[model samples]
Target: METLHEIPALRARLADWRDNGLRIGLVPTMGNLHDGHLALVEAARARADRVVATVFVNPLQFGPHEDLDSYPRTLNDDARRLSRCGCHLLFAPSEAAMYPHGRDAHTVVEVPGLSAQLCGASRPGHFRGVTTVVAKLFNLVQPDLAVFGQKDYQQLMLIRRMAADLCMDIEILGLPTVREPDGLAMSSRNGYLTPAERARAPALFRTLQELAAWVAAGTPPAQAERDAAQALSVAGFEPDYLSVRRRADLAPAGPQDTALVVLAAAHLGRARLIDNLELDRIVAEAH
Candidate 1:
C-alpha cells in the first residue's frame, strides 16, 4: 500500500526488507495496470515474501510516433488494483527521477538474433530502450526475482537472456498472457481500439488459432505462414508479420521440428495488436 516516488527511499525500503531476510519480488510496469498485470503481481506474491511494483511510464522505450504522450496513466486505479492483489510497495517515479538530467552514458542489452525479428523489425531501438530501462529498474529495485508477462514473448526472452548474460542474480519469471474474453491480448494500446475495430480485433487471435491448426496438420511452415497471412487479410487486418519459429531460439521452424510457435502482428485500425500460439500441442491433438 505504500507508494514511494524517490529512488533512495525505495532502495532504503528494499534494503530494510533484505536486511531482515525477506525475499523481494519486482514487477516493473508502465502503470494503467489491468488483470494481466495483476496476474504478474499474484505470481510474485506466491514466490516472494515482499513484492514491489514500479509504475513508471518509461519514455526511453517509446518511439517518436508512438503513444508515449497519450499512454494511459491511472495511478489511483493501478494502486487500488495492486493493493487488492496484495502488493507491498509501489514505486511510481517521475520521468525526471527515472532519467535524470545530464544522463549521458547508457547501458544497452541486446539479444542479438531474437531482438532483430518480430516487434524489433518494426520498432528500431525499441528493445534497447526497453532493456536499458529494465536494467535500470533491476538495479534500483534489486529484487530476488522479477516477473514479466509472456504476452510480450520476445521481450520476456530478451530480458531473460540479458539477465543471464550479465550474471544478474535475480530470477526472471515469464507469466502467461492475460487476455480479454474476446481472445484479444490485453494491452494498454487496447484502449485506442475503436468500437468497429474492437469487434474485428479478435480476428488476430482467430487467425493465430487457424495458423496453429495448420501447423498441427503437419503443414509446411511457409504454407502455414502464407495461409495465416491471407486469413489475416481476409479478417480485415493490416498484417505486419506472420511468422513461425522455434519457441526457444526463435529461429524459423524447419520441416523436422515437432514444436513451433506462430507469432503474428497486425494493425487493426490504428491500433497494432500482437498474438501468438504454440503449435506443438495443437499439432499433437491433430494427430
Candidate 2:
C-alpha cells in the first residue's frame, strides 16, 4: 500500500484511479486504530474498488485544553493494519499539510444548530473544527463514498448534514458502532484509561442500556436523563450530557416520536467516553 503525506500526490493518485474507472472509498481517522477502525476499512472495500484511509490527528478538531499533543500516533502500525484489512492507500498528512495557511486564518465550515448542542456544548468550536477539516478531506479526495463509525453519532449526523447542504456528490455511509465484548464502544481515546478506569468504563454503556429500558417502559426521556446522570456519578464518572433525542434531527424527542436515540458523554478519569442506543431496538427487545 502507498503512503502519502501531501495533497498534490493524493489528488494525483486519486485522479489516476478515477481515470482507470476505479471507484474510491475514504475512511478518515486519527490513528491508534483498533478493531472498530479496521471495520470501517472493511466496509469501504466492500462498496468501492479502491479504498483510501487518512490519518490526520486534526488539530482543528481539538480545543486548547484537549489532548492534542498527547493524542496517540501509531502511523506505522496503523498502516500495517489498514493494509492487512485491504486498504489500497494511506494518507498521513502533517498538521501543516492540513492547516496550510495556519489555523487562525484557515477557512472554517460550521454546521449551524447541530454543531452547538450535546458534545458541542461541552467543547465549543469542536464541531466547527470537525466540519471544516472533513470538508477539506471531502474536497481533496472527492471519493465516490466515505465511511464512518456510528460511535460518534452526533459527528456522523453533522457530517451527513454538511455533505448534503453543500451538495457534495459523495455517498456517506455510517457503519454501526463496534463494541468490546464487555460492551464499551471502541474509541482511540479509550487508550487513555488506566486499568481500573477501563474496568469501570463499561458502566457508561450499561447506563445507556438502562436508559433504553426506561424509555421503553414509558418513562419520559428528560426524567430518564436526570436519573442516568445521577447513576453515572455513582459509578465514578463526571457526567456530561445524557439525553434521548429524535434520531431524525437530534431534537428532543417528544411523546409522539417513535424513532429516538439515547446518547451519552461523560468523563471517566482521563478518558471521556461517549455512547448511544437506539430506542427502536429497545422497544423490539421489550416485545
Candidate 3:
C-alpha cells in the first residue's frame, strides 16, 4: 500500500480519489499494529471503495505521566499488516506535522459532560486531546466514513457526538471489540503486561462478563457495579470504575432504559486495561 507522511500529499491523493468518485474510509490509530487494529482496516475495506489507515501515535491524547515516549511505534510493520488487511493508503505523520503550531497554541475540542467522567476523571485533558486530534484527522482525511473500535467505547461515543455536534458529514462506525481466546480485550497496551500479569489480565473481561450476567438476572444496577469493582480488586487489579450506563448517552442507566452497557477500567501491573460489554440483549432475554 502507498504511504504518505505529509498532509498535503495525503490530501492530494484523497482529492484525486474523490474526483474519481471513490468513497473513502478512515481508520485512525497509533502504530503498534495488532490483530484488533487489522480488524478495523478490514471493516473499513468492506464499507468503502478505498481505505486509509493512519498510524500516528497522538501525543495530544496522552497525559504527562502516561507512556507517550515509550508507546510503541512500528510503522513499517504496521504498514505491512495494513496492506495485508486490504488498506489502500497509510498516513504516518510526525508529531510536528500533526501540531504545526505547537501543542500550547493548538486549538482544542471538548465534548463537555461525556468527557468529564470515567476515564476522563483519571486523565484530565485526555479527551480534549482526543477530540482535537480526531477533528484534525477528520479535516485532513475528509473521508466519507470512519471506523473505530468499540474497545474504547466512550471514545467512540464521544467521537460520534463530536462529529454530529460540529456538523461533520461523515459516518462514524464502531466495530465490536476484538478479544483473545481467554476473553482479554485485544489492546496495543496489552504488550506492557508481563507474562504473569497477562495471565491475570483476562479477569478484567471476565469480571465485566459476570457483571453482565448479574444485571441480566435482575440485580440492582448500583449493586452490580459495586460487585464488579470488588471482583476486579479480588483479581489483583486496582479498580478505576465499573459502571452500567445507558448506551445512548452513557448516563447512568434508569429503570426504563432498555439498551445498556457495562464498562470497566483497571490497572494490571504496568498496563491499564479498559473494556465494556453491551448488555441490551442480556436484559431483553431476562424479560
Off by over 4 Å in 2: 281-287
lDDT of 3 by residue, 99-123 (tens): 9899888889999999999999999
lDDT of 1 at 269: 76
lDDT of 2 by residue, 1-287 (tens): 99999999998999999999999999999999999999999999999999999999888889999999999989899999998999999999988998879999999999999999999999999999999989999999999999999999999999999999999999999999999999999999999999999999999999999998988898878899999999999999999999999999999987778888999999998898999998763333334
Q: lDDT scores for all predictions?
A: 0.87, 0.93, 0.92
Model 1 over residues 129-236: C-alpha lDDT tens digits? Answer: 888889888889888999999888888889998899888999999888899998899988898889988898998988888888877777877898898899889888
Pairs in steric clash, model 1 = 216-283
Lowest lDDT 10-residue stretch of candidate 1: 101-110
Best by TM-score: 2
Candidate 3 to truth, TM: 0.96
- How accurate locally is residue 180 in candidate 3, as Cα lDDT from 0 to 100? 97
Question: Judged by TM-score relative to the true structure, which candidate is superior, 2 or 3?
Answer: 2
lDDT of 3 at 66: 97
Could you say which candidate leads in lDDT? Answer: 2
Two-way TM-score contest, 1 vs 3, winner: 3
Candidate 3: worst 10 consecutive residues by lDDT? 278-287
lDDT of 1: 0.87
Pairs clashing in candidate 2?
Answer: none
